[model samples]
Target: MTLRIALRPAPLLLRFILPRPSLLLHQLPTRRAGHGPGQRVIHYMGHQAGATQPPTPHKTIHFCSQCAGPVDLKFVSSEDRWRHICSACSHVHYLNPRNVVGCIVEHEDQVLLCRRGIQPQLGKWTVPAGYMELQESTAEGAARETLEEAGAAVEIVAPYVHFDIPGIGQAYLLFRARLAPPFTFAAQAPESLETRLFPLEDIPWDELAFSAVSLALRYYVEDRRSQSWRMHHGVIRKQAGAGPNDPGSFKLTDYMGLPLGAERIQTQA
Candidate 1:
């Protein structure tokens, strides 16, 4: 042939060959053992910004984050939305939602959970998760907390559930992960009294620390059975006549029906 020069592949094809930067940062596990590509993906359900109940003054609001002056909850704006505003300095102390990261670490057919030894829900069972720290991705925070609480290494699979708890101004990001080899169990975490793996049939549904934890576990079990998993994201609203700190009132009426064996944890005074 007179002209038989080979042409390079197009840039778009090269782009398709490259891995996603964000996906690489998650540190996905080598073995995608659980389900299909659908199950291994993160599907955004949706988002909602429900109004939070008026937060109680935890203590004497004697100072502000901005000026350290005396502050109190009042209508800082003409819109009638109450906020913590400084009376002395007129600085607004905008309260923000606290982000908590946790994971459902699966090994074979079992899931790892931790028993809390601290307040809020002391002695109750929960997936290993806690307040997210600064300068870390959600997956990193979840892995760190899982290691600290369950003493196990995990590779995050995908974001499993997102909870918008306006009642306490808490946003929970729960991920699905795989337990690394040599799965270790240690109650070394100060906040955790014990850590253990539970089969789907033996999960302590009645003793789960939070409603979202129970919901996530149930979803995990059901998804594995159907092999048609998808992300779950929704808002949980406080029940009428319930305070911001009251866990008994939080329910997912707008999401899937109430989780199995649901009961309110008696709020400690």
Candidate 2:
């Protein structure tokens, strides 16, 4: 594996925009044939390169962090495409879905959500979530973020939902929580446009930036009633037209000529 890079953060929105903190730690594929769990993996470069298209993300591989040894590469076709396993220690350097953590901070039947005043779905609504900081627990990150974004104190209730996907390298973890009574809020200006507590019915489904928020809400509702719930991938659910060797270069955004939220965030310079 010639490309030797350290673990990096997830995309801007996944890290900075959501309300839940989800740190997706994955084991690397192993290099040896008979191996233990958590070993790292490496996918040697094949002769045929996909130059004219988006690089096949699945074909990507990783190497040993210390020894620079060859790691294993185990790529499941459907669900597990996101992780690159190390063949040796089964060590996993999770691909970027960039650990996001947020709380479902609430009071009675109402939920808390924040409005974005910044680019990348600016003016859209979502929870008070963000990327995990070094030396903090996921729950800590979530609780701390809730206070910062909403400017309201909160207590985490229970673990609610998790959105996992390998290809796009993003995951989400949300918790049920209650805002400390006497809820007080300020714009927190740039991070959010406004923060409010709303009854479940008042949530604006149409204007959410990432699809995971709605998916988490849906799962939360069904979970409450003992209804059969499916594990939703949130933003990175499988697509039907994808080929085994398909390069994920083109999509609907290309057709509509819409600007990606990241693009807008960059232009704000």
**All candidates' lDDT scores?**
0.66, 0.54
lDDT per residue as tens, model 1, 61-89: 56887777888877533443567778878
Question: Candidate 2: where are CA atoms >4 Å away?
Answer: 1-96, 224-235, 238-269
Q: Model 1 Cα displacement at 28 (Å)?
A: 29
Candidate 2 displacement at residue 83 in angstroms: 13
Score candidate 1 by TM-score against the native. 0.69
* lDDT per residue (tens digit) for residues 68-182 in model 2: 6566656544443445667777776665557788887667667778988777678888888888888876767777788778886665554555665344555677666666656
Which candidate ranks first by TM-score, i.e. highest? 1
Q: Which ranges in model 1 have alpha carbons more than 4 Å from their true place?
A: 1-60, 240-249, 253-269
